[model samples]
Target chain A: MREFALIDRLSQRLANRRADTRLGIGDDGALVAPSAGQELAITTDTLIAGRHFPVDTSAFDIGYKALAVNLSDLAAMGADPAWVTIALAAPELNAGWCDALLDGALAAIGDASVDIVGGDTTRGELSLTITAIGCLPAGAALRRSGARVGDLIAVTGTLGDAAYGLQCWPTRDNATRDQQFFIDRLARPQWRPGAALRGLVNAAIDISDGLAADLEHVLSASEVGARLDIDTLPTSESMMRSCDRETRLGLQWSGGDDYELCVTLNEAQLDRARAAIDCPLTVIGEIEAEIGLRAFDRHGVRWNSDKARGWDHFA
Target chain B: MREFALIDRLSQRLANRRADTRLGIGDDGALVAPSAGQELAITTDTLIAGRHFPVDTSAFDIGYKALAVNLSDLAAMGADPAWVTIALAAPELNAGWCDALLDGALAAIGDASVDIVGGDTTRGELSLTITAIGCLPAGAALRRSGARVGDLIAVTGTLGDAAYGLQCWPTRDNATRDQQFFIDRLARPQWRPGAALRGLVNAAIDISDGLAADLEHVLSASEVGARLDIDTLPTSESMMRSCDRETRLGLQWSGGDDYELCVTLNEAQLDRARAAIDCPLTVIGEIEAEIGLRAFDRHGVRWNSDKARGWDHFA
Candidate 1:
């Protein structure tokens, strides 16, 4: 009964009235009507205490990041976010804690028009599994397999701020403004909309496991390769001020938790895509006929891709 | 790298080459094409170790029940199973254990025509969260708000056997065939198809948190009451032989996890509904003008609902 009472209270805090959601919450399942000519894009992600984030991380940030990460996946597919189901498990039902967590989630979903449709609340070790549903025009899905040889590879926003933020977190109170920027980036990753880039990008993926590893997924799927210009990789002003060139370069390439979009497009579409997107877009690589990734510095010196590795949870 | 490798292996084991699933497994989000004139039904559930099931429960049964329970939700909504996204978290990635778990999930999904779409794998305390998507003809969903006065309330299959199974699980090897029957019900709750009952039933819900509790949800939603005939609830012969009368009645009313459909319909549709459904259907109650549930024996003696309380994760 306490679980039911808690869910009822939390459901009210998250509820939104939307035309597409015929039924929401308080049901066995939610009924959703998709647009006439759109296909549904579905994704699920899980965040666990002490694994995905610091053990002592605030519930507010955890809730915010959970939704942000799933929305990032939808953005990668060039789909418009519509609905989400949250399955939350916690050791106890603390009203104040749950309220703050949900408040942060609502903040992350601000004006995106996504509805919290259905969910299950259970008692267990702290974790959240969120399944986000979105819609895309029937043939407009930006699949990972569509990257072709000669396509220009681009990324939105700067990378490695989140990783740097993790390192400076313990002593965050004494940090400079530059360091605080990194910490904020770690806590609340902005959900960059990619739905407008459908016709401008050949393939797209979100940088959850770092650019080096995530780009490898697109390369493997498309059976192509890429050569990145190390000097062209984007870095934040804060990163430039706080770290040396080597550290910044490694973080830019291999540091994870940057929820930015990495896309491949033709040269002709570059200008139009930049104007269409909401964030800073930078080209750092081009697709190749060869089947693996390689990198080069400004002086044309080759850097082994193996030297900058991405995250592997089990590793 | 090992997490991705394990996911790749398990993905192959659970993959289905489906036409509706335009994109699956290896993407940020999956693209699914729902049939024209159908609304999507979405539901999510989480199963955690030591909380949802015994710590030593087989990975196979854990996988099977996780999917089964979600399917039960879809069934309650009168929807056809379509796709599922499984977010799995575990302490370690054991090859044999994962293979067996996937195999069990496959068995539960046997010939249902549902596809495994997209998911995330994380390291944490063992748990599985499954989000199930189903389809129903537009406006055909059997919601919980349509029951009315004089409507017949019916239940499918048997109840209470699962709760009995839980009690006998620790010494399952020494149990009789009848006791094993109850144990099997707990381990594997069959997925009953309810999509065919859309027009036949006015309202429906799955009996997960015991009929006594779940029925109250329907009464509360529809703004009506019910009079249940305790003598009429369907019970398995195994349940009858293993327990005394009062114990049998308690299990039937309050023991949870039966995964059976509880529905209401006009008396005129009873004969046709019984003929159409695949399983046994028995009328155990009728809607009343009052606003709460009451019970009666074969002799018409009244019984208070509070005596047979339903399971509450946090009471």
Candidate 2:
């Protein structure tokens, strides 16, 4: 059997009626027209085996993570998930594995309320590239360039849990309940934020490359600086007990893969946001007029060196 | 160096300005607002080393061909090229090689009048994926299902050139000027008729999977059938002289990588299309009421049991 034959078989399994999809598989591209009063937001991410994840990772997890990361981007933009197209490359055709991958991905899509529109599958080393399309109300997207000086910088939920979980992967010392929670957070993160912050947040970004680095992205794009209050940065008691203070703070501030939404809001809206969201909201910093970031200790003195580096892709 | 660092380095080279591009390289996703009154048509394709192309192929050619194939998809959809995003994976971070790839890709974008909006780069096995977004008039897209019974099936440019070129790759005995032309076509095919066929074509698709298979896709999607006149299928004089009659006909009918538009049109529009396009339009078949495809030789006998197959991704 050839590649086309494999695709034909796979496509048969994928054939189903979708209301919004004007056209599906077997064309040059999928065609879709957005509903009235909604604008489309599209994002693409690629994951390569043995680089993005371990080769031993299950196909189900790979599918779940690929869709999860893309959905995180949509959440950051304050857009409602809509559609996705996947371009998959694998060394060989394993029908059972492919079915499981699709099942996992479809499960994620069901949770996100997004549809799999169309995509291409080819033979190569295992790699997945997914482009997600979302929809937002007219003039309602929260962009990175909207932050202003004196605004309160905030983050959703706890940070560094995922990084700490990764560290635990090397040594399976503790099989405690808290340790299992952290491990699950690293493996399958859920970015299910409350809808109340949709129009309230001014500027937002997902914490993929750690707090320090991702915050830098928002500040730089907004043409402003920030001053993080070191003591106010949120972390769990389990993370604190597992690692030393310095390591805990470093991982919390610079460790990536948390997938939490880092947002900036006006000082006046802070109270309303705190009351609305189910997850803990911490005002870790404030937007500043300066050109770079600074972290201050509880005593109001600048803590640590200004050369804090987060997870760099090519580092 | 880490994967994110490599992305940062490559991203700097892709940073530039375009009026239509709402956002460029460094965000969760690149955002673009198409011109008013235009509909966006998006397509993505992935090329892997040792699969889509030979590993020894030039990086520049690989980059150029990657974008070209996506552009061919847009052309088949009767769309005006607008923007593209590339997700690249490689085993190593060679700055010079990456620069060369970008240079070739940018050149092709310039020629096609498309903008490089954003992309992601990571370290992995060599693979390149590109998602192309184009704009077309609000309701003028040429889709596969739009073909009607009695519609003439026409193709742009001669076929079998790329297949013959691949045959000559091992032995340079056929390395004449004509063979070189075919080789160039295999490496970098130019899409024909350009955006001129947008409003005129009833149904169209790019011929990347050879005429036999790709045409079958159109017929199947449209719930119609076709009777191809094998003698009417276009074949270059050089190809006919170099290969046997059966082989020449097989290449012309089933050769992949042509990138030419296979279109279906009403009889009334034939004269208008002939006047608009520079390439010769060969009417090789007509849409029938039944489902499936058939071919007839000069003797009016059906040409069944074709052994020539198109490019398959899984084989």
Candidate 3:
């Protein structure tokens, strides 16, 4: 397929024509009118085959994850997703592959009401860079710098499933139902909108570089510390049955690719935040006045985190 | 360099912290408030090492052009550039290489007052994807679909220099002064702000895919035709001296990578547009009510354009 033909197909199928879109695709630049009094939230992420994911990953999964990761960043900022621009570099063009990729990308935005405004496509090693734009009320963004001492640290949904899912990916075809669940989690990480928890949460971050490392970012940014109870970290029944206690704890703290939001909130707002967030909420830590992150078990034994290395693309 | 360290260095050097920026780098997303009564103009472009440029090209030029190409798109829409997000994937991290790349990128935005708000870094075949966001007054954007039958088609600056420059690129060190000029044009295509032309031009497009092909886009989008004069096509002094008439014409019509603006305006508005646009302007065609683009010489001899193939990424 030619570039124009591919672009036309994408424009027709994926263009989310919203009321605020003055001009969508087929222009030099997309023109969008943000709602008055709302600050635009922008984030970018790139996924490279063989680096960010297995090279054998399906086009559908690649496209889905590419957009999902950017939207997850928007969610962590307590912003409502408004638009996305994708820059795709593919080694070659295949009609069926393009169709599947577009389908998966559209599926990723299911019911989020965000638009695909504009993008660039060229021939290169298969990679996707997606920049997502969202909006939030002025002075209401859930920043990492807002994590105050004494705040209760909470996380949404079960953790470590995606990392466990990677182990089952290669044998996904012959996998058990529980393994299929883990594989699906690995391929398609879920992200909840943080807009509803804007006032309730003091700080928020998406868990992409494992729970411990990401919480460390919050601590550094907010100039505070955290004490995480490893036993309280949420885990699925499938995960519990699939691994030993030590393995489960290690995965929960250091396994990456879980797009769930890890938030810090005041204890008084716990009930309100639970009512506002439409997902499983578990308090696994607390923001402290100290200068570092510490983890402990249910038996009050200090768990050494010195050896827990998080995901690093350049390392 | 580790991922976080590289990120810290980049955040310090390239972040364009504007007053409207509520949050910049270091957060999940950057937050910026656009001025009221303005529409956001967004565009994205990607430059791959082997595809967009030579594999041996310096990181500096690649970085400069990556952002310049996106800014050119914003200029075509008569928008004032405001912010940008960069997603860089490199095979390896080198400090000097990274520093030069950042310097070149900053140099490209000289006096444009645009800011680097957020970005992503990863490991892959070297590639840079920049998404530029600009703003324009509501309903004042120059669009490709706005041409009229009587509009005078015009172009800014000389054409075909970049294509000619490519021929001399490999031996640029031994180039003559004139050859060096052309080489500079190829490496760094100049883009002017189109904000002043917002009220003057009926339609506009940047000449990236050669003049003939880009003009064809305007004709197709406006549902009109054009009569281009082959003899009236502009050429620089070096271009005129380096090639014969036919060679110059071919390069003018079929050669790509000249970031000049092609615009259509009324005869009455021509004087105002010329005054408003900072670069040299030349009229090469006229919009017709007929169905397709046609070219002719000064003697009214029709020039067949069927053989002029435009640049296509897939083809």
* Best-performing candidate as measured by DockQ: 3
Better of 2 and 3 by TM-score: 3
> Residue B211 in model 2: shift from native, Å?
1.3
Q: Give DockQ for candidates 1 onward, in order.
A: 0.77, 0.50, 0.89
lDDT of 2 by residue, A1-315 (tens): 466665666677665444655556667776655565665566888888876666766788778878888888877887777677788988786877887788767766654556666677888788899887676765677788888999899998898898887767654456686787677667666664533577788888889878888888898889999899987888887887777877887788788778888999998898888887768889999999997888876777675434357655456
Error of 3 at B147 (Å): 0.6
The alpha-carbon lDDT assigned to residue A273 of candidate 2 equals 84
TM-score of the A chain in candidate 3? 0.98
Q: What TM-score does each of the candidates earn?
A: 0.98, 0.90, 0.98
Give the lowest summed-lDDT range of ten residues in model 2 chain A.
A304-313
**In model 1, where do residues sit more than 4 Å from their true spots?**
A299-301, B298-302
Q: In model 1 chain A, where is the ten-residue run with the lowest total lDDT?
A: A303-312
Q: Comparing 2 and 3 by lDDT, which wins?
A: 3
**CAPRI quality level assigned to candidate 3 from its DockQ score:** high
Which parts of model 2 have CA positions greater than 4 angstroms off?
A: A1-20, A35-39, A137-139, A170-175, A192-198, A237-241, A275-278, A297-307, B1-19, B35-38, B170-175, B193-195, B237-241, B299-302, B305-308
The DockQ ranking, best first, is 3, 1, 2
Candidate 3 deviant stretches above 4 angstroms:
A299-301, B15-17, B299-305
